[model samples]
Each structure stands twice: as C-alpha cells, then as structure tokens.
Target: MATTLFFLLFFTPFLYSAAAPNHNAPQDLVRSSCINASYPSLCLRTLSSYSGPTGTPRDLAQAAVKVGLARARKASTYLKTSVTGKSERERAALSDCVEQMAESVDELSKTLSELKHLRGETFEFQMSNARTWVSAALTYEDTCVDGFEGVDRKVKGDVKKKITNVAMVTSNALYMIRRLDESGGLNR
Candidate 1:
C-alpha cells in the first residue's frame, strides 16, 4: 500500500504534465494561425481570449470577427466620450469617427453571422460575402482615422492611436477570413 501511494503521488504529476501540452494545443494553434496575420501579436492576443472551440478555421474566423466587433464597440464608446473637451474641429472628427465605427460594427456583425452559417452548397458565396464585409469594416476603420486629419495634433494622435488599434484587429480578422476561405470553406 505504501509503494502504491508513492507511485500514485510521484507519477500523477508526470501524467498531468504530459497531458498539459494537449490542453494548450488550441492556444498553440492560435499562435501558429496568427503568424500570418497582419498584426500577428494582436491576433494571438485577441483570439486567444476566446475560450470556445478553436479546432477549425471557421471557429478561428468567428472568434476573430467577434473580437473585432467587441473592439469596435468599445472604440465607439470611447470616441463618443472623447467628443467632450475638444476643439470644434476635433469634435467633428470624433463625430465622423463614431459613425465610421458604427458601420464597422455592423459589417463585422454581418461577417460573424455569415461565418456561423457557412453551408457546403453555398460555401464559396458565403465566404466571399464574409471577406467583403470584413474588408469593408477595415476600410471604415481607415476612414475614421482619415477624418482625424487637420484636427488638433494631440487629438489627432490620440484618436489615430485608438482607431489604428481597432483597424489592426479588424485587418487580422480579415486575414483569418481569407485563411478560412483558402482552407476550403469548412471542409477542413
């Protein structure tokens, strides 16, 4: 009984350690998947936050879009609050950025919806739409930054920094969507 207890205590940790990497296999997949993203580190950071299934390209694509949507929403709230205590021009720019972020959120929502319902018969068509919407979301993010031009330097810098972060995440989402498309649209 003493020998069995010693074996159980000594070997249990080794058994758990051996299985630990398999538990982290999903995170490793996320890391490798992010390697090709425009913002690889951000992609890894954002998608790694998802505790859902990440065993397939579709799963990763959905996670990316969801992360982008959440960021866009948060940015919109920040922009709205930032409109106060700004010059008139800065206020205008912030207002435009708010609208652009709203559009971005809408596009990302549509992309997420499409990703969730990707059927084999219409797989190509759905993927094309998803890519188009994600690309449009990225464009809207870029336009938000463009609106900040000619505003106060500090305001422009602050707004640009926030918008750029959102844009990078959205761009990463687009990359994931394209990767999903190239992965044969859910067949893998």
Candidate 2:
C-alpha cells in the first residue's frame, strides 16, 4: 500500500499534465518577456492614442466604416502571404475582416440615405452615385472569395476601403452633404 501510494502521488501529476488540452496551455513566459522587451512602449502608445469617442454620441456608422477599412487592409495582406494548409487561422481572420467590411458598407449606405433625405436636392445625385459605388464594391467583395481547397469559396480584401472611400467622397461631393450631416468630415 505504501509503494502504491508513492507511485500514485508521483505519476498523478504527469498523467494530468498529459491529459490537459493543448489550447489551455500557458503561454511561454520567456517569449512574452522578449516581446515586451522589444516592443517597449508601443502598446502603451497605441492605447493612449485610441481615438474612439468616450463621451459623445458614438457614431456607429463612422466607426463601422473605419473598422471595415482596417479589416479589409489586414485581410489583403494576409491573402497575399498566406500559404495553403497553413492558413487556417489566417483564413479565419480574413473571413472575419471581410464580414466586418461588408457590415460597415451596409451601415454607411443607410447613413448616406438618411443624409440624402435630410439634404434633399443638394445630395441627390451624389448620394445616388455613392450608393452605386458601394453596391458595386460589396458585390465585388462578395464574389472575390471563390474556390477554396477544391470547394467554391468567396474571399475579398480591402473592399471596405473602396466602398468607404467612395461613400466618403460622395459624402463630400456637395458642401451640403458634409454640412447637413453631423457625422464629421470624410477625412475623419
């Protein structure tokens, strides 16, 4: 019984360690230290520089556009460098980015339509053109990702940027479009 207890105590820890899921494994302390050492104050700077509104009416439309553009850009880069069979994570991330871009474009369209109604004649043509451009970009992005691992897939990158840019330009097409709406400038 003494020998059995000793063996149980000694082997239990090893058995549990082996059974643990790999995903739950703790990150390497040394690697984290190295990253912090190399990056220094970069993370702090980013956190401090965040421009998201803190007290104002958070413009969901504008935020969506910005996030969409950023995600599209990231997806573009990922697609450029990703290799087959090793891009599961990258592919998933790209999909998420594309989805965000699409959602932002939709939001921007709705906002533009509202602004058009508010601005009337001043934004009529410009808003119409902007909608057309956004629709085209969305369609392009939606169709870009086709054929994945021998199956049909639709992947798009930076589409949000294109749509946002067009919407922004349209938003600025007439002086009234910018002035009538309180969403700030396209440059923002």
Highest lDDT model number: 1
Tens-digit lDDT string for candidate 1 (22-111): 767678779989999999989988888887787678888898888889889998999999988888988999999999999999999999
The positional error of residue 131 in candidate 2, measured at the CA in angstroms, is: 2.0
Candidate 2 worst ten-residue window by lDDT? 25-34
Tens digits of lDDT, candidate 2, 68-116: 3454454445544543553565466445544544654454455545533
Worst 10 residues of 1 by lDDT: 18-27
> How high is the lDDT of residue 47 in model 1?
85
lDDT of each: 0.89, 0.40
For candidate 2, give the lDDT of residue 165. Answer: 40
